[model samples]
Target: KTTTTSHPASISSTTRGLSAPTASHTRPTGPTGPSEPDPGPGSPFFFLWASPDNPYESESTTTSPPGMVVDNRIFEVLLSLPIWLMVYFCHSNVLDLYRKMPKSHKWAFPWLIHLAMGLAAVVSIVFGYARTHHIAPQDVTGNAFVGLNIISNSERIGLLIFAVVALGKIPETIRSLRSLVGRIAMEVMDIESIMDTTEILEVIASPMLLASATIIALTIRDLAKITDLLGSSSGVLLSLVLPGLVYAAIYSTPYLDIKDHDKRWNGHRLGGFSIATFGVGLGTIGFLATVFSW
Candidate 1:
């Protein structure tokens, strides 16, 4: 009998009806290890590089109508509003930076910074829309192939630059986050008397605990869903609701001798109350939508 051999790609195509380089494709044996197929969602090592299925996609089936698609998109945008507001207005780093700036530098510098930030955000949105305008939302899930196929080299470079800028901010961001956390802890625990102890714990324990929790969260399969849930709920409260309430309370307070500001039912007071009311409705709907959709 004549010996016969088949190419791996041909064998896989014929036998499994799948193309080569799929998750089913086995690694070539090397000195380091035995041959194994690529790690998939079910693999023990999947968490390391796994991009979970789109939670929104799973909320609707492939047969969903155009109306349902529109509805889903609306809900997504609504939920995202809170997160965008959070980042733009009430982000810990931004607030911290504003607090540290001198009175002279505050007005002009902040206005310029915000102008640049707003322009950058608008440009990013436009760029993303231009690139992925042709792709269906359903088709744009977090799969690696989707990103690789859609993002051209120029777009990739832009993304890399943005990533670098983000990375550069990490140190300042960490300090801001730590300070915020310490302040919150102090307020909640009423630890004013034990200030030195609180400071020690905040310095020593907080980072380690936060890092550990972050690592644990990364290992979760549905991290995106959790993130959305958080963004819709706590993010809304912090960014929109609290700011509005605090503003109104400060202005409307009868006892406090707030200088250079009127403590009356003025436009500022009305605006603050309006924002708080809007936030209440937005947060409730967003949170409900996220939970129900998930």
Candidate 2:
């Protein structure tokens, strides 16, 4: 869903190598809604959440207040944001990375990598939830070492997989931020020369950006606050809305140099609008959930 006018070369390396683990890193935090009950084994959406037997279903002392109005269904709906956010991260960045590839490689590698990453993400979610879902939410909440503790105490390896994936994301994130900043600069300043001097700019800007980010991270009392904000806004825009809008615009009228038939464009146009509309609703819900959940 992310759009970028920057030279795709800046991100192609990350797209090629980092996706395997990055996708896995994202799946554990994904959300599920009340409407979509886990359909059990063989169902397509089962990978999206843990088992249908939610630990929160019962009125409990640890997880929820007694006689709550909506029961645990409300928690299910609120937890659904991370899955879409994962989609946003994976889907939006792929376009830019794919554009950077030579036409020969474009049709094969990037797509295969995306598919592989998606599969890996699903696997990660299944493995993660299968192990940790038994634990009460209150036990894990605000516990930064939960994963470490889980690994140390048990033979379960789900958290171990996540640890490896998270490590892989560190470099990818650094490069992505640098490229994103450079692209913004190019757009705002109208300086095409900035791309030509990208490495130089990175040398100067990287340290400054890192310092600024470090400062912000230190100052923030709750890192999840920022993550929730970004997930609702940037995540939805890039993952769902922008892609739909771009597709619709490209296929409309003359159809952006693509020589596809009118019939195909008609279906694509409708699908694009549908996706965008869905994104708007999803984003609104996600935003409200984030704000009120606090």
Candidate 3:
């Protein structure tokens, strides 16, 4: 008998019949990742980025009403806007840069101040975006992407500038705050309460709170910026460990009592503003932390 061989067309038709359907025709019954999670109480940032239901994930089945979505960016904006205000307010607290410069140079300094603030606001915006989006550190580096190096380095340099300025401002900021406390206390609370040691004990807690807030904000911001460039080990340790310890020191120390300011540096009053200054610095750092996050 003559050998009967299937035609190429027939073989191809059989293979097609056995093969899977086209991608366009297929539908996925389940998500590639986990299913939608339950809702929780907290700021949108905590709920969206760090929730027990599902930290770092959102889904269609969320408690959020249908046809409505809260962009966690609102929380990011809330977190960062305060930092802009802090930068503006902190300008007055710097180590008297204008005095060292000539009186003739006064007008020009305002421009520099504006430039610094503007740059800081922009950087804060950038960090806010990165934190909200959960950007991987490695992605921000390398030559494959244009302008990233410049942007990253600029962030780092800006941080250095602010860090130096913030450190120098601590003393004066403390003094100014100490001076303002009595006025604020007088305006809001009774003058008797302002002067009371018992009331002052309650008041003294404010500085540590300031330090804690500062530690949370600045440490996180600095860690976020440097972690990718330098790796997370040192940054993480410094960010988490130092803040607690510093705050503890503030808590443990007896000098956090609200006190008067003295202009001269060489008396029992040298550190008069020290506690308040630390508080102001903490507030600044905390605000900066919001600009970026871990």
Candidate 4:
């Protein structure tokens, strides 16, 4: 019976030889678990964030064809510009009128004018849609589209009201114009000099009213055509650009002593401009929609 004990160095060497081979064998296979990839350019998430394919890349992606979105937005803005300018001018005139009126008469007129304009706008919107869509009488009976028909009819009624109200103002407008002209004639000898602030405003108002009337008439005659026009690029330019130019001219005129002139330059003019811009945007959108539909 021999008692042979292994030396500490021999035992340690044996352990190291076995462990070194096992470690070397395992390392060549690389990681045992799924390894994470680098956040590279090829990554889908990275591409989505940085590339054009991503809808979230631009604000206009809510609509198709990024270029169209920009164009339509511009058109819609332009279309709405004139209305905004008219509103501003009307408001200024109303304020001037109120200031000249007795305290008892002031409150009613302002509210009335606002109501009239609002009614007119609502009517125009409704009638224009209804006439263009050509809603059938039978279609309204227990149909899903009935609501739209009703809305269209309601708009027509609103237009009627607006027209009535506008017509009603004719007498007052005439009186004011006459009085203004008389005052101008008494004050100055020259034709240009005779045209005082009020007379000049009246002149502007007359043309504005005539233009509005023509537009309204055209809209009434062929609302579909008007809608088509409004949805077109040219329509947007007419609605927005022309009006904006007119507003800019009026706003910049030193001779016109419109109240809050400075305030208008700072604030109200922006609103007018915004409306036109909105028209441009809408027109562009409409055009794109039409084109894509085809």
| Top candidate by TM-score | 2
lDDT: the better of candidates 2 and 3: 2
Which tens-of-lDDT digit does each residue in 17-115 have in candidate 2? 111111111113224511211111111123223434433244222222244223234324323433443544434354465456665664464244345
What's the ranking of the predictions by lDDT, best on top? 2, 1, 4, 3
Error of 4 at 126 (Å): 1.6
Error of 4 at 133 (Å): 10
TM-score of 4: 0.28
The residue pairs in collision within model 1 are none
The prediction achieving the highest lDDT against the true structure is 2
Clashes of each: 0, 5, 3, 32
lDDT of each: 0.39, 0.40, 0.32, 0.35
Off by over 4 Å in 2: 1-50, 54-56, 59-221, 253-257
Each candidate structure's TM-score, on Cα atoms with residue i matched to residue i, is 0.34, 0.38, 0.26, 0.28
Candidate 1, residue 7: Cα displacement in angstroms equals 44
Which of 2 and 4 is the better model by lDDT?
A: 2
Model 4 residue 45 lDDT score: 19
lDDT of 4 by residue, 1-294 (tens): 111111111111111111010000001112453221111111111222333343223222111222221223332342244345334433324334544676566436434434533433333332222211212121111111122443577887876686577555544544443443343343233344444655686778778866865876765564433333222443334334334433433343333324455665545445545655665564565456434433
Q: Candidate 1 lDDT, tens digit per residue, 1-294?
A: 111111111111111100001122233456664443321111111211232332113222122223422223532443354345445544545544544666566446324433533443343232222112211233222212322443578887875686466444444444444454454444436566556865786688668756855764566446445444444544435544555544443344322213344534365557756765775675665567656654
RMSD of each: 15.5, 14.7, 20.8, 27.9
Local accuracy of candidate 3 as per-residue lDDT tens digits, 1-294: 111111111111111110110000111224463322111111212223342344333332222224332344543443344344344343433323443665466446435434533443343344323322223131221111123344577777986786566555544434433434443344334354455643574477557756854675656554433322221121111222222222222222223212222222123222323433443443344334423333
Cα displacement (Å) at residue 223, model 4? 15
Alpha carbon lDDT of residue 100, candidate 2? 62
